[model samples]
Target chain A: MNKRENERNPVETPAHDAAHDALAEELEALRDLFQKELDRAKNAPDDAALPVKDGAPDAPPDADEGPVCACCGAPLTDADADAPYCEECLTQMRTRPVHAAAALFVLAAFLLAAVGLYLFSDSAAQWRQLFSAQRAVQEHRLLDAADRYGDCFLMNADRDSVSLTGIKAYADLCRSLGDVDLAALLVDARFPGPLLKLPWNARYRALLKLQAQFAATEQVAIDIFGAYDDYTDAAVYEDVDAQLCALRTDDTYAPVAVEYIRYLLMKAAGKPAALQMQQLEQMEAVDDGCYTGYYLAAMIELAGETGGPDAARTYFQTAIERNGQDQNAYDAFVRVLRRQPAPDTAAIFSVAQAAQANAPARGKPVWLRLFAVSDLLRGDDAQALREMQLYMTACYEQQLSLTMEEWNLYALCAAAAGDEDACAQIETALGSAQLKLSPVIGRVRAGTWTAAEALRKDGGDIA
Target chain B: MNGIDRVIRVLTAPGVWIRSFWVHLLCRIWAVPVTETRLFQNKATFGHLQHMAPPTVGAAFAIGFVPALLNRLLALLLFLSSLLGLFLFRMTGWVALSANTLAFWFAFSLYVNTYPPAEHARRMQTMLRGQGTRAQKILLAPGTFCCAVGSFLERRGVTFLLACAGLAALVLWQGALFAAIARWLPNLEG
Candidate 1:
């Protein structure tokens, strides 16, 4: 039958449908046998449910020498085993434990972070809470605000400086609440202990700056060196001194500098006399006419204040030497000299000489000679004659001319010498000069008319 | 009164005559080039007589060290002063600095004989072994501070010496401490 079937295969090749049918029948028979065997094996389970002498099962029903399920330690290598996870442990391994654990950890971290965020969200929440706590004390709620800040320090990054600022705010609030001691305590608490063991310059500066900020305007002077109980920092004293000195030295502050310098010295050095010494030194050092005359006067005044007659005389004498012709300095110097316990006379002579030496060239350079003449007129006849002789020499030898006032002095000198013609000549010049003088000048020239009276007559002091 | 009589009264005033005389004298002194100040000037030299000249380093040192050494010698004469105390004497730098400058140092040594910074400890030695005209680091010793004597000769002279000394000492101490720490924490080397 196989030989004839084999021979018929050629015909099957020739007809594809018949050959396909034959092959399908063979596959069906094999499938039927396989299904029967699988059914038998499935029905004949539970034979190896063995117990040991210890009354425990020797092995699991599906145990075999192979890799087991990681979750239940069940042998899972078999291709066709009922309940592949050994029936009892099938539900355990399929779930996602690693992923779930990760999710749980992340959730826990999120909750912690959220809690932190809520605790220290912003100053707004703290502000609200404090505002609600209305009390007699002004902003007594600041204590609570401080407490909130302290809580934030434990959780937040960048805490140190923030905490310090909060502490300062608390201190300010306490001060506003009329709790000065508590405010002081707040400052103490806020100071960084590790960094500041000795007296801290920063703290001192802060205190001074604060004083400058809050002091009552009426209670404090605008000057840098004004008296204040809290102006204790050495650095502050130095800074203020420097600032005031800078202002005094500045050309812009020059017109008012004299007054300010006096005030500054009186406040800083606590001695009005120091003003004189400083002014004298500055005058000697300065090259410009920036308050030169003012400085001389200041020195005189300082000497007067300190009752240092000798010092006053010396300063005046020096000023006279520099610019004796400048009536302002001479007058002020004379005033100081009068204030002395004992006035210096020689200084007047030297000042006169200095003035003569420094006088402007050409016509009647006699301001210094006049100072000498006045000194001579004050008492010393010999000195007066000597000054007059010197003046005459300079006038004749240098071809210099004398104005009317200078000629008056010459006339007086001639009268002393019994020279009638010179006196007459001076008198004629004086008369002519007087006649030619303007109304204002004529009024000033009249011995009876004061400058103020002349100014009143003119209706203004303008030239 | 007559002008001559008035002039006589001015002449007789107590300070006036003397001041005027002094002014004339000052003027005379000022007129002489020999008496003129040579400070910050080029005309000054070893041979010439000058005025108000900048102090030479040797002269400054001599002036500073003489009085200081005298004071120290006096201390030695009185009692066997602590060598350290002698070095820290207040008047040790008085010819160059201020009086009462070493009160703090003396007090500190007496009460807390704690180890001073290395540079502070080395100050006297540096002073004794000075170089030629090294610039002053500090101008004046404070009431209580440890600064090198050499620094007092230099410009920008206040507290700079002490600070520099302190910094050097701190660096040395830190280096030593770091070495010890390195040995202790071997793992940190990595």
Candidate 2:
């Protein structure tokens, strides 16, 4: 059957052979070309192996043979290997026309946004005015600054940083211009609650109000309290004695008189003790019920300085007799006792016990701390630790920071109790505050010294 | 580049991309033909434009001016809002705190990207030098000067440093103000 078919289609057979020959020849030619290109690529230098331009006669036969430009499909040079596009494509892209409609759309959007923001949000304008005010202040243009600040205050009443800072700055400017009343008014109007509670702000307003009530000649007395509040130069208080005497006649200014006298007594480091005692005496004579604990405390301090430990003891007895419930008198007596070369721990413990029994809830931390100190002095480490724990707890409950001496005593007690962790923590706390354990406490922490040794060093009898 | 410069470039790469995006976007808005936009490695380039005419003063000024203004406005808004959210809103718990922190980060990023790139600033300088009215030059002079200075500083990474210092100062000032108020105010937790 095949022979018959071949015989019937003899012309078709030759034609098919001819077509096959042509196809084979073409395949052979392609194979040879590919081989030659592969050879050339192998023989080429590193630079020559770079991406050849598309349609170039010397282009690599296969696209996958090497890296090519992402944009143009040309083989990339070694230098351009890291680059996604060839230099030509990059150049072409650089010159490409931007979409005009899209560009206009974006431009319109931005313009609309700018306009919308300017119309809707007044913050930008307020901030600009605020900056202008700050600049005016820098240039000493107080009036312009004040005006700008006034504008700011009217613009925003929120207690944000900008508003608060503006309020503070405006008040400062008003004060600088000698318009204390205006400053007070502005602060009172703007800061309703917390800001007015600050000591300086309260004092500033008080001074202004008091000055308004008094004549210009009597303003100096009000100024004295202001100066004292501000910690003005001590020389300003040089004639404070006469000032207090003048202020004492007015019952309204009696508190001021008492405060100045207390200041004089406490800060009278270089001044003669006799002068401070006389002032204290004057305060006592004019005293109202406000002359409770602080008066007795100050007198005890002065008495210790003037008449020795025995005299201080006598004053303490008198103070206790005057008011056994006053925590400050007991605190002062214990402070005086502790300062002695040989502190009477028994007496301090007894005094602390009495103070603790009589002290108000607010005054409990003071007595607790004194008890701990007395226990520490007596070398009763366990009792001292227990007392200090109570003292610290009481202080924490009251939200009070420990005084420097209290911190020292706490650390010493911790060391005497062999609490390394507490000692380390205490050290860290003190170190962060730029303070260090006292030398005796440091020795105790290192285990080189004992509480008895510390007592002996301080001339205290261990018994 | 030195190691520090390289690190700074890498760190500021996102800021550079943001700035370039603004410039390109603005270019399109002005109908200026941009050839290409390339963001690779630590570099970002918005291709040259086919200026149909001598660049207008408004176009030149707006190209750098608008983006810078927006960046500052956006940053300030974010910063103040974050501060308000943290303090005023009295938002408690870690989630609100985290959100506020993220806002602060975004605000700082925007502040760092406030200045245009050196190329955009150069383009601005060229347009400013081109023919324009005397009044236009006087009006745009400050903007031009600021762009030049900002670009100069941005190249040297000084703007990044300045942004950091400025953010720190803002935080410290706000913290001090809030702390002072909080000291006397009733407990927010309650």
Candidate 3:
């Protein structure tokens, strides 16, 4: 206060007191001016910090009853203005109930859940159909498999509607069966346009084309050989004679062309074996050495008995040479070699070793198993056991479902190697001694059988 | 005094008796029901202001509709003013060198406007701005509280009914304080 300031300064004399009083009054005026400036800057009203004019209840309370906010004094004359108090201050005084906001949040949440459930239902039904089709296929009901798969095509044949789950399920099933061409035949006859709209539809088309050629070949084979169980089981036997003439025309499908040619050779029988030989030469000229090509080469030797020992040897050698990364070519060529008169153990062992050398270069697990059998036939017990172990490990790595016969064959390998521990591992891995076995496997188990019996009865098909 | 003797003394002079019974309460601001009670010696000392106090308080509770609401609005304005004054830069204006000047004036309006009679109004103004008796200060508490309650009752729905109830309670409460204050009137006049 100015009084306090005067006391602190201690100015003396009437003139000094008068000067101090005058200065105090001046300072007081400046202080008031500063305070007014501060209050105005803060948007505080003029009387905002003032009390009622004391001892004057007689004075008019509102003076004139003009518009002035009785609360925070913002002007109320402009557009969107409110009197008595500004709109913001007045709203602060009133509280609305919270239940309306709570209702909105719940409604929003329910709508979100409804949308999510709606989107998921379509894909979920598609998945369920695929699973049931797999179940039917496992049950050996081919008609049911085709029907369920057809239902899958109906759910979404549109490219935009197809999901990764559908494509992956189809691809995995085909690859797991290891018979893309035949399995496609069993699941089709639906004209496949919708299936063609699917991802990886090319694989399906290729296999399907292979399947058609195979059907044509089967028809021709049935006409010549009669409906032998080995030749025909899934199709009509009587249609064979009606379809035989179709084989004379050149087959367009690369996969089953060899089979079609073999049937043509059957149709050409006694028409001078030279003509049949010329047809085989022409087929070989166009061959690209896929698994079908090498298998057809071996089949050519078998179809002509007079191709002789050297010709048989040449075809088998060439088949093994043209095998590339696939396991099937070696399997077919070796099977024929094992069935050879005075079976060529040395040549088969050399071929198996060369294929074994290709093992690390993306070679198939089936090649290792074939080599193990080759090693066993060559009487190399340790090499056979090692290759067999490698084959089992490779099967496990590839998630290949091995059959009971393969399990029994592993048991035989263990027995031949004289390793009790290896035999116990096979039993433990198979989880039961009462495993399903083919009769040939039962004969091998009885210890009165040959290695050829175990090798040739590779019994995954029955299981 | 002993408890029984004091109780008897209070019972004799009903005006002072009612005032003294509230011993620990220590202050009396409201004028007693002067015409209704035997003030004996205190009645002779009555000035026009003293005579008007009780009637004025009764009329105040009855007439305090808009005034009561205005008093509450004043209190709200005072609070906002004080909040700004505290938070903002504190360099002084000539009039605002001291703090709460608006609040002091608002409370002054509240006290004066809510009392409704000239005499009570004057005394209410005195009590707000100047340091008065301990009794005067204590009585202001209920007086302000009654004003606030009466004010809030008129803020929204069922205004007439709730305001009437609030006013009735305020009148009775104020009458008691007035009675207690009146207990020493004769003594003060001497």
Candidate 4:
């Protein structure tokens, strides 16, 4: 491998030739990118021409000559005042003792305008980029967009009263990117003043609520937002509740409503009247409003918080009355009713009637469903068995999806129904199969479940 | 020689030489505005610039006059609020301790007038020019803790109990340290 020998056959040394070829290709690619970028730069609308020294169009190009300076197009020379300026005009312009102050003012104005335009264009570009990035999350692109947005804010710190139309989009983009904390920080900065007054305050509240639910930070949330009624009381008088109520289904509003409810409970923690109001409002959902059963169940729990056993029973009755078609609500109401020493026996009978009537068609299955299991623990074996049949019919007949929790509930119902053989078979199948018991179920088994007292237990060992 | 003459000679001689050396060194260092410099090319300068109080009260005081009673009161309030927030969040003593440290630095740097801003600026310029860098990331700075503390205290309902107690301890310890150090080496300003 002598130097002369290697140089003698440039074509024969395949490896070296290939290496050089690769380098050449890489350089060509890089050059192409640069060319493309340069073309873009050239094509970009030139603002520099907008405010010319005298605000007049530069002199036209000579018909026979190459492109010349639009201003004072005496034969353009590289050494002329503007370089592209005509010699005669260049000399005249230079001799005017270039008013340093005037020139500086113009320069300052130009720079200011340029900076403003640059910032506007950059922000617009960032918003567009963020939109596209969110549509299909590319982490690096999103991060780049975030950085650009941050730069814009930092650069324009002087304009503290900037609008947030673009920033909202940026925050939303951050949310989509799963940078919730960053999105929140941006929101806090960009959305100035008290958030409670915004039209989208409800939605913001809803989002905060959802976040609270997801993060289990409801207590902290309550501390920050104050009581819902207190916050909403004045607003409600102004028909704000109507607006908020209308917004309930808006993805933005749903989380806020849930949050408002949670906050309401927090605020009413020790106040009896406020606590009752929380129950009453929730029961209104159960009574004649849409999606009242969930509210009714929540109300019952809230009632318990107030330590009003009678109020809890009344709310449970209201829940059953509002949705007799929902057997689960009827059953839950009955179970809660049974726990109250001042039980409404008449309501229980009526609820049982509704349950039996609403029981699924095509007969129930052999496995005890969770509803049925709850019945058994509530000292209602017949209702429990009936629910078990419904579960089996849904699973075996309708081929409905049954999670491990459902399966376990079914197995328990079977064991409670004194079908030891059936219970053993279900248990063995469950144990052998990849029946993933949910954390809730595992916690229940381990005596660590939230609101476990609401879950009726007590079943014998499976055969 | 008289005692006064000896003292004056020592003071003037050292001060003149040091002042001349620092001025020459710093004039070259601060030739360029720091904000225009890139972070990577001037890491130390960037760090110092970034951490440079963005013309806030603390920044002004740290390099300016001994913080007035009002400023100390304000700083004390902030220090207390930071501690209260930590306590409400059920944080350990460390957070409160950190907040107290912030208060002390504010008092020492601003109230007690340890380092003059003019002197500090000159020193910084020299360091910046020599090393071509600023401070570290401002977010990871003691200044952040101070700012956070100040803001926390400014919020409605935050008291100054914790801050005042911390300030008392800090002033005492600082005085003791100054006295001890002065015995052997003498005071720079004196």
Q: What is the DockQ of each candidate?
A: 0.01, 0.03, 0.01, 0.01
**Compared with the true structure, what per-residue lDDT tens digits does model 1 show for residues A278-354?**
64565446313333444566666576557565666676666555433444455455445433444455655555454
Report the lDDT of model 2 for residue B160.
75
CAPRI tier for the interface of model 2: incorrect
The lDDT-based order of candidates, best leading, equals: 2, 3, 4, 1
- Work out the TM-score per prediction: 0.20, 0.33, 0.30, 0.25
What does candidate 4's lDDT look like per residue over A395-423, in tens digits? 66667665665565555454445555655
DockQ of 3: 0.01
Encode model 2's per-residue lDDT on A76-135: one tens digit a residue. 777556555566765554355444543443344344334334322434455455556655
Summing lDDT over every window of 10 consecutive residues in candidate 4 chain A, give the lowest-scoring window.
Answer: A6-15
The top-ranked prediction according to TM-score is 2
lDDT of 3 by residue, B83-127 (tens): 222222111232332333433333322322232222234434433
Model 2 pairs whose backbones collide = A51-A75, A51-A76, A93-B35, A94-B35, A103-B28, A103-B29
| TM-score of decoy 2 | 0.33
On DockQ, the candidate that comes out on top is 2
Best by lDDT: 2
Candidate 1 per-residue lDDT, tens place, B62-122, comes to 3233323332332232222221112211012221122121222222211211111122224
* Residue A293 miss distance in model 4 (angstroms): 4.8
Error of 4 at A273 (Å): 14
What would you estimate as the lDDT of candidate 3? 0.45
In terms of docking quality, model 1 is incorrect
